[model samples]
Target: MRRLAYIRALLLVGLLLAQSRPAAAQTNLIRNPGFEAPYSAWGGIGPIQVAHEWTPWWSEQPDHNPPWYRPEWKPAEAQFFPNRVLSGERAQQWFTFHASHYAGMYQQVFNVVPGVRYQFSVYAQVWSSVEDDPYPSVLPANPRLQIGIDPTGNWNAFSGDIVWSGEAPMNAVIDQWGYMVVEATAQNNVITVFMKTSPDFANKHNDTYWDNANLIVAGQAPPPTNTPAPPTPIPSDTPVPPPTAVPSDTPVPPPTAVPSDTPVPPPTNTPAPATATLPPTATLPPTNTPIPPTETPEPTATEPPPTETPAPTNTATATATVEVILETIEPTEGPTALPAATEVVAADSGGSGAVAEPGEATGNPPAAVEEADSTAASSTILVVLVGGLALVLTVVVLLLVWRRITGAG
Candidate 1:
């Protein structure tokens, strides 16, 4: 009973330590990127090409830049400004959108990766035209603007399968442009855009203009967020070291003794018995009569055929193997609530950016995200409670069994 008590105490202490552990293990790591909104500044409009540094012209209104925007007139390389994706309905807004019209493509590969998501868009001209095809055709074979998985291998000109394809509209083609925005899988960082065919635009090869190519998070891992805090170039001055404290010697308590409770004895199932030696010379006669065996023919060794030695048979043994599996249980909410090493990734996801707290991370999870975390925490608590209850029930059952066996119930 006393041994059992010590075991229980130890288990309690262990569980307490477990509960007190910090969160944020590698297992809880999560990465998600958002959409890159239209760079038009306005809500919509596209199928325009910008140049100079090789950019794209955004589809915004009031600035037609054309009655058939002059080819030599050159436009701006349009890009989504408030880049990256939105979380959900409560999310600010998804950046992913599609393009409307098309002549050529503007393509570039970025060095910096923004957030955990990659952004891509498709533009097509349905009702209107830039070069204005005489006989407009809404063919399903409407050229696609592609984004391939070329890792800078085959640079300058992109080379790979067409990633962005726009479904051809019905025969109502007057020749105009449409838009479609999307977030690509973060695994591929390469970006490119070019018309699949030269139907409307005459010189498809030379006409595709792209500019203002901001490839955020191109080389580095995904950015914490699209609106990442601007980098501070100037380094701060060296911090002054605080003065070390001096130790003052006071009269220490002289060898105080700790008192221990007396150890309890374990209960025994049976009483100890006295021992005696057996007499070597005394031969006791058997009182009980033994049944006689029926007579049967017994073969002599010489009469029997020469016996053959038996082959070695496989021996079976009562053996057991113990295996330990480290099921690194992760908290459902995420990593523990303690500071992690620099190697651990922290999602600095937010439009506001992460403001460093005095001794903690500045970012707060969105309301939706917080709700998910709370649900996870409740689940963990429920599991622990059920486990504890089961253990207590087992102990009670054991006690009842002992009482019944000893007739002490």
Candidate 2:
């Protein structure tokens, strides 16, 4: 009973392990993260909109606030946006590490779930132009770029700013850039990313760049640890089963060594019978020899029978008629030799005594077969011309031999 229980427990553990699912890879939730398009998809502050998907934010306060204020956050084209851009051209440009720039931009992100941890990241840089701000000697105030999430699109319901930095500030140096990443669990479904720069009244040419903003859902936690199984206690009063009661089927004894060795001698002797079996197959060679003789006689047998058939008799009669006509024409047309050969070819093609084809009488025969027959007739005429030239040469040699014998006499 204890063994049966242990077997059942082991099966249950294997079943659970088979049914468990593996964790999936993390996916990004933010759309149009590079801000390479027009600002039609993003909500922007009225006059200070610099780049697409990017809105500038300031620290100014107004009582009649439509939030119509601009802060130090502005757009600056990186090295890749094609234009005769001024020292501070505010347009989306390609970054060395990213596809395009956001340049101080933030937009509302979708599909954020509550209590799920997410990672947000962006590459940001700062640029200063000699034409815009000439005062390099005076150290400028560092710029601030902030990312935040808000449940509501309004500024009042702002969740705490995303903690993308620990002790290091989110400030970018002039012509230097780095990635800023933040990890936090969302409290709501909608995430509104924010980008803000610190107000610098003294520095007019300060430009900040942001690009490749992304939001990725972090990996989920594994299932809770399984509870430990209870320890099995040993029985004290149970009587032990007899060893004789164990199954006799399990312990199969190996065959006796004498029997195994005896079988080896039999196998050596058994090869004689195996070799004896080959003679019956060797006798099959006599059977195969009779087949080739029968097969070789087949071609000679079939060829003579075909020549005796009525089709060959018809063809032979046609060729004999063509030969007599050629001999009669050869006496009159000695020089016009090829033309007589052509006529012979036409006669052999059954020109005068030709039986009408099955389709020709009812106009049902295919035109294609008629064209093929015409091509075959032309090829046969060509072969006859070559034979006629050889006949002419043979006649010329016979006449020369006759003349030489007469002159020798």
Candidate 3:
């Protein structure tokens, strides 16, 4: 007896120690778990069934019940409530989960920690029609509890396939609410819990009801609704930068290169005029290319190192006489010759004007050199502009023609 008593005492002490160790307590995380409150926060089509069960006249729309209560299966009869309740009208009544129409409801829980296991559970019941003449009451093969991690925390997050489908033994009574519980780990901050019906039958009346949802986080305290305000830091001229601050310095350097690039193109274009004019002047036969000799006269004035006026005057006279002779021959070259003549004159003026520019810079005048440089630049720009425009027009016509050919083919 003493030995037996000692054994019993030891067993009792073990039980006591186990109890004192403090098993983890789980708190329900779901808000509005019961549909008793207005489901304004709830998402999807089904409305809150304000119409009570058992009351023959109770309806989804009590005030305007007659017009809206027509069920598709039984067109002759109409009721305010959805199908039939699981139990007597008073004991069982809630939202209906219709598989045919994909009717369901979902609620989002915020501030959920990622990679943490959570216990999710809900109470639901299968709904069937009352009249069984041709149509008998049908229960769904599978009902589901969908728990998911939605980064956006939107209600539509549960709109896709369930992370996992679950099932529970349903009672024969239409109003009996059964338990469908599941365990899931959140992959994001906002976890969505949904009560959904399965698409098991082609024409199956897989209607179900849902109430009393529970979400519990294991081994952690529930998040508080009102988070404490962060501590204000001491004022400093150079504050610690935010993690989200973009590197403004990196983008600034790229824009600086564009301005440097823009100024470079114009300065580079200044030398282009010198090249275009030098070719025609170097291949000088005043009649061969009507414009060069006219330019040669201007340079002769500045070209000779000594007796600048007399030598330059003789050259100018010779150039003028040659241009007159070319103009007289221009009419014989036809209408084509008129444009050629104008082009030759423009090239001669610009080329010769540019040649005198260096002398003006040294001994003559700064303003004269600037004027000559400006004239040469203007003529070069005009020629380039005309050429670029013609090239662009040709490209546009070709693209349109190609598109039409491809479309026709």
Estimate every model's Cα lDDT from 0 to 1: 0.28, 0.42, 0.40
- Report the lDDT tens digits of candidate 2 across residue range 1-409: 9999999999999989878855554555665555543443123323243455444332222221111122322334446542212223233321111011122345666667777766656555554332333323133334444444443333321233333232114233345444555556676776666544432222323455565566676454322222122122111111122112221322222221121111112222334688998889878877777787867776555554443443533444445555665555444332243333344444455557444532343222344345445655665676577556655665565556555544543
Rank the models by lDDT, top first.
2, 3, 1
Residue 322 in model 1: lDDT: 9
Residue pairs with backbone overlap in model 2: 54-105, 58-71, 359-365
What lDDT tens digits, residue by residue, belong to model 3 across residues 333-387?
2333333333444455555433332113322344444555555556556655655
Residue 25 accuracy (lDDT) in model 1: 26
Question: So what's the TM-score on candidate 1?
Answer: 0.22
Off by over 4 Å in 1: 1-50, 55-103, 114-117, 122-158, 166-174, 186-190, 193-197, 200-409
Q: Using lDDT as the measure, which candidate wins? A: 2
In order of appearance, the predictions have TM-scores of: 0.22, 0.35, 0.33
Best by TM-score: 2
In candidate 1, what residue range of length 10 has the lowest lDDT sum? Answer: 315-324
Candidate 2 local lDDT, residue 271: 42
How do the residues 176-238 of candidate 1 rate in per-residue lDDT, one tens digit apiece?
233333333333444443322222221111122211112332223322333323322111122
